[model samples]
Target: MSSSIENEYFCDGLTEEIINALAKIKELSVISRASSFYFKNKKTTTKEIIEKLGVATFIGGSVRLSKKKMRITVHMIDTVNDFLFWSETFDRDLEDIFKVQDEISLFIAEKLREYIGHIEIEDKLVEPLNLSINTYREYLKGRYYLMKFDYESTLKSIKIFEEIINEKPNFPNPYLDINQGYAYLGTMGLLPADEAFQIAQPYLKRALELDLSSPRSQLNLSWIECWQNWDLQKAYEHANNALEIQSTDEVYLTISSYLTVEGKLGPAQNYINKALELDPFSAINHHYKGYIYYLQQDYKKAIQFLQKSLTFNSVLPFPPIYIGQSLLLSGKFNEALEYFDGLKGVSLKDLTKLGGKTMSYAFLGDVSKCHIGIRELETYLNTELMGKALTFLVLTNVLLGNYEEAIDYVELAYKNKLPIILLFNTEPILKPIKNHKRFKKIMIQAISDNSNYTPIKRYRHSLLHTEDISKYVKEMEQVMMENKLYLNPNLSLKDLASYIELPTNYVSQLLNQGVNKNFSEYVNTFRLNEFKERVIFDENKNVTIMSIAYDSGFNSKTVFNTFFKKKEGITPNTYLKIKRRN
Candidate 1:
């Protein structure tokens, strides 16, 4: 695709370098490379690419290499206005390719931060690589085949990547790719999850050995622990470690998945919202966002985002299942049946398909077909030994009105530490039976077993004595009521700690333990109370709501209203009007 002697070696590589650099900035929503480079070599207009990819802008340019010297031209195009934000040309010798690549990537990031809203580009976008062009090309070639996504292509990519590992045993990236290759194989059902993750672990272990601090490496181990070992505790630990290091979309999604299965719907939705912000165009993130809504009983929004996810990738595992369930939950039984039967992307072997068909039949009151689907699901699980599919059986049982059977599965799942047991508390279908004595007992036991991570995962491990926490709570309440520390609009845990003359850790622990709220929640509770008191008073009627809100330490109107509704079950304006009238 190039006329020069060293054609495109730097161009394609440089593009990938730019993508890598930008992806590290969690503030910017950079689509994954597979989605970003989807426009490569295609005669697609900038408008079409941005619309399809749901991006604001993109980087594009060309490279022409004639012997040791290369001429590179690059520009940022704002797809909305269809004009150049910035452009630059570099004429440089190819001897120091790593330096050139890093410099160019950094410059592009600088330009992006300048053009776009405030982006904190503190870290270098691209890392230094000391290697031959051949090694880098081989790595790119493996990536090329890996992205092809076919079985043979993945095998070829894995083989090439392993060869690189043998050649450069110290390099971490190839090992990581191999880990991903096996992960993809497992996710696509080409291999058993156990076998695939087992094969992937050694490579991931090497990656960890090379860079023990890598969040990505920790995330991969988290996946292995969750899916293969069924160890949610260990998985949560590794994932929490990764989250402490990086806030990437992948880390957010994985943590969200764990929280969702654990029936922590509120925190689950919060994490998925973060993921969607960082990778808005990702079908999986959208699917998760929909699933969160479905669990929270918001069928309309559930169906909306699930359908949106399907528009991007029709075959995502969860959306089709949940969209159908959402429709059925809305009493569109016939429509649910039609939708379930019409999905071409769902294979009969998929857990999603199995669960969807069973639930759809049951929702439609087709007892015969429901029983038939149940038999099929049981047979599939018994014959294949799919631990992951066990949750679907529990779901199907619940919808079929087999309360005793459902309870039995919950006990079995709890015995095996199947995370699906955690779902019984929040699962919409299980709402009717949630009060069953045996079910409640099992759920209580399960919850007691799993450590609560919200509020303070770290400080809870090394807690102050109960009396010490209670003493601090008294001190905090006294300080809040008298000094009104919550009046500071920009108050923080550290700031509140200073007012009480306590260590920040002890204050956080006391807030979580004795007060049963985090610092923000505790302060916001006081702020909301203050706002309510002001609004209800007879004399303060003429002031604007936002002005009063600011006086009460609720700086952002959005935050004030959101907290008001979350606590009072009505918008601030509605509450204000009703209170004045009363």
Candidate 2:
């Protein structure tokens, strides 16, 4: 009843007489002959068709004519119970096709009406949710794309969902609606962490409010919180809640793998196995199973499962990355390099680069290049532009003997108030710096909000020459002053590179050779020193926190507070008050 029977199926190839007669059926919920026939000869089962059509009973038939006579055969099956309740065969002339279909349809409807009236089937058939038929179709398409798990195809699904919502804004299908945004955020990693969460939260919240009966929204939110914010407690509750409501979802357990990596193996294993049963073809599911073994430090088993994942979707990045990571931990650096070599030029994004570059440098024993890789990762972290990528950098930095740099990133985790230890423990790249005293101390302080780097390749292209270096830096500083921009905010080597019209890597090289400071600490040192001087010497106290923050070129109040606390060990307000008292 939600969709006009005419809109229910594709009857494109059927004769007009047949289409019109089928359309006239008063009782048969005959999906329009055009729409129902769309699946002709396609290998879909009765259950799948019933689910797709949103109908409890489906009536199908075939017609044949021989020796100038026509015969019709029709069967009506109870899809939910998989039983053929009624069937009939009619013999007639080919010209009587329309009459046969109409008569059969009328007869079936009258019989159903009588059966429902007598047995009260109408009382039990809960009316379908208030969803536009078009939106529901789009949602099914979105689910189809999600099942495929390829990046490009998944993105296409998101675009369809966007179009669906645009077409019908008030449609109550919130779970299907907001899932597109979550996919966008997860895929693009465009917004900063807090900003990303803000974008995704409304859809998830609305989904919960609209349908306590649907678990997909809650399940997605739980994973995002776990992976993006490291909020395990909330993740556990949401994930468990979803499984309680719908026990068949595979992703419900995949989120638990993060907890497993933090040494909660039993729950992790339980969820991973359940997810596999629900969707056995998912390469990602297999990768997680392998990841669980790696978490238990069981390298051999990890290798086996990860390899199996490759057979299903050879292009999937994590299984290869994890295999490489386990290889590194097992001291098979050379073998790890072989793995990373295969991953180059694949669309593994920033985080994969961290793992691939780390293993490559470590296996080759190129300590200086390893540090260079770590510096590049530092540039990524201070920007906080990408979470999965930043996670990669945090571990890689520790691996390359740059625990001091790890301090800078952990400062970010603390500012977000995320549990840094949990992440640090599971991330194989940080295996090198796990025990450093300064790193541990900073992790405990819960101070410091690190700024992120913005990628600007246009700026990087201009500074390939030595002469351009001074000009580039001077122009950048001038732009900061011209705009009164905060020097301490999420400025990356690329931003400076973009400012001067040079390449990012070139600017990094110039800074290393000319300025002798890596991208982040170099910028932070300038900001911190300026902050200290302004508090002590700017006596008129006309510099309100917001004014000074802008003058210093900081972007947000949160970033300013975090930077101030980490650099000076006091809140900005308290620091200002103490300075004034003195």
Candidate 3:
């Protein structure tokens, strides 16, 4: 990167934009922003990065933002053969950043056909962020903090995004990102799920009205409908929509959870399996898998997977609660009590801390302690956090042998449209009332049939041969040799592509695959060759090297020297010294 120190934010934002755009293409297995950015500023080989990330290819780049102009030099490398797949340098006005991102994503998709099979690239991914450069910089700052993925950083992101909302109220991304920040807080139990979603819903609605296709928007909206609104059917529908646009572990997990709540365990297992396949080490996926088993009354497998999930992420709030319940359901009362006793400060939620203890004490015949938890829950019912305690209250009553009271709570849960009832209703603790006439009536009333759902069909284009790019490659070479276009200091990929009367993607594909260099490397090779030709002449000897560099189509002094050193393993001055002596 070359610019004021502040442009680092701009550079990060540009990269994230490209990642975001490419991730929208359903067929491409684009790496996450955090995962790919891990190699930034690290001294790592291309093969190591590709293998470590488990990707077939990867893109790397340099960016320069000066005043209103932006330059991005990017390259894609094929991991299998260790060869350059495609690369280009984009030069555009700062406001045209969205256009540049879309162009790169589409071109990459076109080039990746041989590696990943046919991919569908949309016409656009990110909406045009129509803001002053300064405002855009602020938005980037917000995104930078948001990607940190911690409580304090997420809250910081929320505040910054709030400021953007105040200044540029119509920009969809800031609105969407504000929702994302709040969503992280809600899920981590730092904030009440109801409160967090309520705070973000207005902003989220505006963002969706502006652009509903963003992957984050769809996922966030689905969660809101599930957790906040209790509209499980609509939640499943939104999740399906998001998966169709971009199949991610998050979307797959969300669909799995929704399917689980509908008592569709087979489909739920399939979705969760897909989620785990994508992100095998994710603790959340493990937790959901365990929860699915717990619902199936398989207490032993439930405890095993839940314990595995806690090993990955120890502070996760609900796994401990469920593990205790699983232990009790397995008839290990002492183990259940011990597990509940060991949960010192795993969560801030009062219900999570109390539910397991209350149930453990009930089975142990400690009536006083059990009622103490029951009283604490009753008090919670009178507070603003009322929705938090109902699920646990139902389970506690069942464990206390108050099957009738548990049934009453079930009716209340159904009246309030709680989505998790169908799921936990399958718990072994509920076995006594699960088949009761009244319980059966409520079960019928609680679950909505989302089984008829079908996702948006992902269409693939007809395949093309790998050797087909050879024709365009030769045409690009002929155009370059005839026009001496490298002499133009301000040339870009678009300009060269236009001169050859080929689409920009076609020319870039050719240069990257056939010529084996990016646009910057390809053009700079010509200029470097031109520089060498001129510098050796007696007429140019008296002329300064810098002046000859300009005459040879080298634009910036930094770029010229850097490219020369990288290619020749020495500076231009040293190269001139060696050549002139010979």
Candidate 4:
């Protein structure tokens, strides 16, 4: 009898100890048992496993015990072609069971090395496990629970993994698995990026050092570098290295999605294609491919691809929002509205709010309602709503003849680091702003911030004295400082313009051109900055962020927190803790 590597190792009735043992082998890339066992009982074909696990080779075997003796058999299969590379069986008395494990591991490692024409130093260093095989059983149970992906189960798994690791610190797999959990938290945006990276990186680094060719360690490190560090170039290089070492797996596809986020549409598309060839049913690759098309503004093609993506995920809200927008832009207005209606309660606001409403209004030719939606979008932009709202604001403002407002939105969008505007070189909404030197400068800055490209021009203040336009609006920084206008609760662009004896039109233009922000944003950024500074410096004041918001001239604490979190990437309390730590 043998263990199946799934919930049950042996069929019929057999009682042999089953230990999930990985090799102490050095160079061959191995997927960690915890991650690999997820597919143990899966009905997926071998080709599917090759793509999903990204492992080129898979091994299966069974063990049986009778009369105080252990008999074992193992088979090695090539995943890409479903070819059997080797098969073997061994028999040993109970006293020699430990020797049996060591011999089998060494035999497999040496045989593979000779077959592949290279040998690597064994990297596995075993730490003693204090518990019975029952402890290992609990660990496997924890893995099963964690794979269910519920909060409670994950926490249970963490506790189990911690217990195991505390008992065996040198056991590399548990450290790697726990680190994967932290990385998952970071990816889900549940934890702060810095904190998550701090918890995950060291463990992953150690895992790699312990097993330099372990595909799991490489996968985790590459993903952390891409997602947490935002080092796309390094991520690309690491992912390429991992793929070269072992091709046909989920790790490569996961890394390719990062490239898509960076707007490397062509490369991302090609990499995902390779990923799908290895694992044809991977929903993630299809989902990301749809996003690349969406970025390219191919609404029809994007819709088609995204629809196929939905077949892979029928319930994800994000893809539907993209589909709705494509439908609206493609003139299927009623159908678009239906999709929006479908998202009423289920949608995340930042995903659907401004874009859905604005598209609906614009498609219906309800200019007044469209402008109302635009105002709401502006309000959201000034406060904290990001993503599609920012994208819609940048596009809609320009389309609505609000050129100065478009530039202002562009500046704020750039500051927020929205990718849509950063990719504006190919965007059409930017056409109205393209010829204006001010808009060009804003685009350049956005591109630089997004792409880190060289040759980006800085945002310039309005030229008060130009040859064709000899008129000049006096600079407003001193005026703003004198009145403390930015911090004033009742302050508005109109009030500031009136105070300076300048027309509101001229003031708006000057703010966008000179200050590179809309009136609301220009004021809010200063307010938020001041709020942050005071929160740090005024420890004796015993002030809450709410109180600070009012004192700093913000009318709403909600607005204050929204803007604060966006700018700082953490809650006020967390920021305070970080400040205290420093």
Lowest lDDT 10-mer window, candidate 4?
11-20
Model 1, clash count?
A: 0
lDDT of each residue in 386-449, candidate 1, tens digit only: 4446666777788888989978877866665543455556778888788999998886766544
Candidate 2 Cα deviation (angstroms), residue 448: 20
lDDT of 2 at 218: 65
lDDT of 2 by residue, 383-434 (tens): 5344554566566656656677666666666566433345555555565665
**Highest-scoring model, lDDT:** 3
CA shift of 482, model 4, Å: 99
Which regions of candidate 4 are displaced past 4 Å?
Answer: 1-231, 248-251, 254-264, 297-301, 313-318, 344-582
TM-score of each: 0.64, 0.52, 0.67, 0.49
Q: Give the TM-score of candidate 4.
A: 0.49
lDDT of each: 0.73, 0.57, 0.74, 0.59
Compared with the true structure, the alpha-carbon lDDT of candidate 3 equals 0.74
Off by over 4 Å in 2: 1-133, 147-151, 172-184, 187-191, 224-231, 251-255, 382-385, 416-422, 428-582
Global Cα RMSD, each model = 15.4, 32.3, 8.9, 32.4
